[model samples]
Target: MPSYDSWPSPTWKKIIEEQLEQVEQMPRADFDIMLKKQLPMAVYNKELMTGDTLDAYLEPHAGSLGKASFFSHQVAHYNAKYTESYGTDLPKLKVPVQILWGEEDEWQPLMYAKRLVQDIPHACLHVIPKAGHFVMEDEPGQCSDYIDRFCNKHP
Candidate 1:
């Protein structure tokens, strides 16, 4: 179970609320622009967060306001159960767990990775450098290598 002391920052809450409120009134292009501006926070490499990349990332999400609404609804209700815990269940996971985490993740702190490693009996963590929340985007080669190695080892 992930810690939720300050999981969703005020900025994320505000963004979700803004998306929910303005989805109908705002132009789709304008909403995309507004959302694209916030996308860089997920990536450590600012240079990789180009206009084309942002557009591509947003394309899949563009057709579904319902998806956005569902996420917003979840976020709205998250606070009510933030403190819920499943400490006893984590150790019961018998499968091998490989946690590929970003070293510079701004959203999820490194402590979560440490906590998970401690909780899961057959778990290992690999903190990829020069990566943020979107570790694969930030360091695709490293992410691919780690995932391939994990899969091969487990299989």
Candidate 2:
């Protein structure tokens, strides 16, 4: 991840905004194609998904124009809002927090996990090897085990 101050680079933000603008007008078939193209970046272990699993992942993304637009908006404004607030907000989190990050995440790099652990007082970071942005999808068993252990320790 880029520094919070420079997150969502101007070029990337422009591209996402343009995508959001066209999403409402896109046909469902075309949107599905776009999702298909994007799937690889989301997971590190491609072998984990069968055709049926791929279809299952794409299913909920149908009729998701609103969701896409909302996500785009967040990305567009992350530097403006989230960066300014997280400095103050993160340390306020009093409860134990587990940050399960994907070591191979393309969208958010491992450096972010370090930054987050530094920012939050009660947060511990776990980096799952061979996992991308979709950690649970790339390594479901490891992700679940981490979650279970976190819960057991915290509870």
Candidate 3:
């Protein structure tokens, strides 16, 4: 029964350590540098500021948002739905589709890219280095390049 914030903290660490007997892995220095470079562009400053202010406003009235639930539910639902929808016969899309995925994405592994290319008739796959699930956010330039290439080829 760990809360969202606490799940990533001491309780989860102890459980993981006990069950998996795994040591915490520190981020590589280059990864930190890449994160610093990417975070600004990833965050919509105005939206972030607005969301923060709204959170502060709502903090005083905790009951306003209604019943609290496991934060992971939404993510689980989306993942399940995505898998279900894509499991069917692939769409007959004529437009050129580019599947850009991060090599380091834990949520959707690079194998998904290959599966996508196989499923989609005109799909091309691009794997971005040193990126995670949020590939567009992590590698904006690479994402833009993929889009540009797709457009050029399609046109």
Candidate 4:
């Protein structure tokens, strides 16, 4: 994805600022609310989040993820540094590369995967069908299989 690009062409700071306000205003830090609000955007399949998976996943890292300042710093850092690194320098990688992406990812679509593969030498992209940004959560078996295959090929 293009650095600091969006539908409205707003910088990363603006988006994070809006989210920071929402996080502060929420009545509870409950995972359920987050699941209802953000999970659809994160996960491609709701079936993968059944039982206590979301709770278990969030409980361990809730504190750090809940921090507004930390999030703001991350957004700023990424927007500031990404263009110089990933956007511009990605093609410099010489080692074998495998891009494992969710095919249904709306945030970063298959085009980004293709772009990465095209730019990086010895790079291949594997798209996990019916999966979104959280590909591991949506299709753990396929994700793991692709990773194992890639590692084995590299090794």
Candidate 5:
């Protein structure tokens, strides 16, 4: 059900291979260049945040994000462990489970959420409208409400 239940498709494989090469070379980052790339994709609604907010979000993580070698190592480890149990690793989970996702997620599309719901037993999915990868930032009140409801159900 999950996209990575098997090896990545050729397109992804190519991207991964290219990223591996880039990470190995450990290229020096130009933040100005990177920010241009990051800002456009990071959020669906740029207007929701002030320029200062975006800076605050990106600045602290800039160092970690720049650490290509470390990033590559983690990716390699996860790639090695990829399996059919990828998304449903906790199938027999005893606790309550609810999967909340952004309906308009640019990277992870609707199919991913649908597959996740099918794979995880008893996991209900909530797709927040007009939301992207950053659901909390996109719909804070609704996200909080979902969290609160999940907590209440479990407790």
Candidate 6:
């Protein structure tokens, strides 16, 4: 998962600001109402923490951390090994897949959701409106309802 601060586009920042403002200005009840209006069938991740306070939490590690370099090297190493070792004969996966994507997600994009559904034999796709990469945070009720329906249908 990419850090919220790592978003490469200004539009994403604007969206984040709007979401933060929504969270800040509204009481819990009103926030719930707003979410329902935005996305009618999403699940909430109650553990999520947002707003400017999170920026303060991440501030200490913002500079010269070498974290980006480390991850790049790790990814390159895995890419080389995986290509040489498995090629096209990687083991087939049989897990049933349910992809719930936020239409407004700046990080992953909706195309990836479409690709997942296409590539997986038994995959279902649910797209939530007015939501970003953090689907639960952006449209909690919709996410939750989608998960419930997927589970019931599959089971």
lDDT of 1 by residue, 74-155 (tens): 4456451454355557889999999988888777788888888998897999998889888888999998998899899889
TM-score of each: 0.77, 0.76, 0.50, 0.73, 0.71, 0.47
Cα distance off (Å), candidate 4, residue 121: 0.9
**Residue 40, candidate 2: alpha-carbon lDDT:** 68
Task: Please list the C-alpha lDDT of all candidates, in the order they appear.
Answer: 0.72, 0.72, 0.50, 0.64, 0.63, 0.52
| Candidate order by decreasing TM-score | 1, 2, 4, 5, 3, 6
Model 2 TM-score, 2 decimals? 0.76
Per-residue accuracy of model 4 over 51-108 as CA lDDT, tens digit each:
5876665554356454443345543354534443565677788899888888887556
Q: After superposition, how far is residue 89 of candidate 2 from its true place, in Å?
A: 1.5
Q: Write the per-residue lDDT of candidate 2 for residues 1-155, one digit (tens) a residue.
A: 34455456554466566765675466777777766766767688876554987888776665666446545554445554566556667777899988888888777778878888998897999899989878998888998998899889988
Count clashing pairs, candidate 4: 0
| lDDT tens digits by residue: candidate 3, 1-155 | 11112223343344344632221122334333432443333223323323454345334324412112111232123223345554455557777777877777654556667777787797778888877656665678888988987888778
Q: Give the per-residue lDDT digits (tens) of candidate 5, residues 30-138.
A: 5344444545453567675447767666564356454553455544554424655455576666567788788876656778788767767898999999787677888
Question: Which candidate number maximizes TM-score?
Answer: 1
| Minimal lDDT window, size 10, model 4 | 3-12
**Which regions of candidate 6 are displaced past 4 Å?**
1-49, 52-91
* Clash count for each candidate, listed in order shown: 0, 0, 0, 0, 0, 12
Better of 1 and 5 by TM-score: 1
Judging by lDDT, tell me the better candidate of 1 and 5: 1
lDDT of 6 by residue, 39-116 (tens): 322223323433453334334424334233322343223223433343233124477778888887765667757755
